[model samples]
Every structure is written in C-alpha cells, then in structure tokens.
Target: LIKITYPGLLLEEILSTIAGNCLLCVTKLDFSAPKSLE
Candidate 1:
C-alpha cells in the first residue's frame, strides 16, 4: 500500500543521511589524526 511504502521510504532516507554524516565524521577524524599515532 501507499501508506506503508511511504514510511519505509522515509526511514530509508533518514538512515542514509545518518550513515553519510557518520562517514564524513570518520573521514575528518582520519585526516586530522597524526600518522605516527595511528
């Protein structure tokens, strides 16, 4: 049904956004860390 599909699609979108933000944060941290320490 349209109603069920709508919520599922919204959930997927939210999850994708969260995942993208997490990845970006990790990438920034990776670049900021010292090579000798890592």
Candidate 2:
C-alpha cells in the first residue's frame, strides 16, 4: 500500500502544476489579443 500511495501523490502534484501553467497561458493570451489590433 505504501508503494501505491507514493505514485498517486506524485501524479496529483504533476497534474496540478500543469493545470496552473495552462491557466496562466490562457490569461496572457486573453490580455494580449486586444493590443495586437492596435
């Protein structure tokens, strides 16, 4: 059970990190699109 638990925790951490990065990318894109028109 200990072996299984460690991998699960690591997977969750990696997924959360990726989700955070994706959110930042989206926010930056939204902020930039309007400026390009000018």
Candidate 3:
C-alpha cells in the first residue's frame, strides 16, 4: 500500500507545483501588459 500511495502523492505534489507556477506566470503577464482602456 505504501508503494502505491507514494507515487500518487508525488504526482499530486508535482501537479500542484506546476499549476502554481502557471498561475504565477499568468499573473506576471497580466501585470506587465498595459490595458488600452487604462
């Protein structure tokens, strides 16, 4: 059971990290780009 669970937990951790990085990148892009309406 431990062997099966370890990989799943690791995958979840990696996916979360990737998602967090993507969100951070998107936020940075939004901040760097100027809006025409502004």
TM-score top scorer:
2
Give the clash count for each candidate.
0, 0, 0
User: Which lDDT tens digits does candidate 2 get at residues 1-38?
Assistant: 75476998878888999999999999999989988876
- Score every model by TM-score: 0.73, 0.74, 0.73
What are the lDDT figures for the candidates, one per model?
A: 0.87, 0.88, 0.85
Q: Residue-wise lDDT of candidate 1 within 1-38, one digit each (tens)? A: 76476998888888999999999999988888876476
Alpha-carbon RMSD of each model: 4.0, 3.0, 3.8
- On the 0 to 100 scale, the lDDT of residue 7 in model 1 is 92
Winning candidate number (lDDT): 2
Q: Score candidate 1 by lDDT.
A: 0.87
Off by over 4 Å in 2: 1-5
Using TM-score as the yardstick, the better of models 2 and 3 is: 2
Query: Cα deviation of 14 in candidate 2 (Å)?
Result: 0.4
Model 1 residue 14 CA deviation in Å: 0.3
How do the residues 9-37 of candidate 3 rate in per-residue lDDT, one tens digit apiece?
Answer: 87888899999999999998897776633
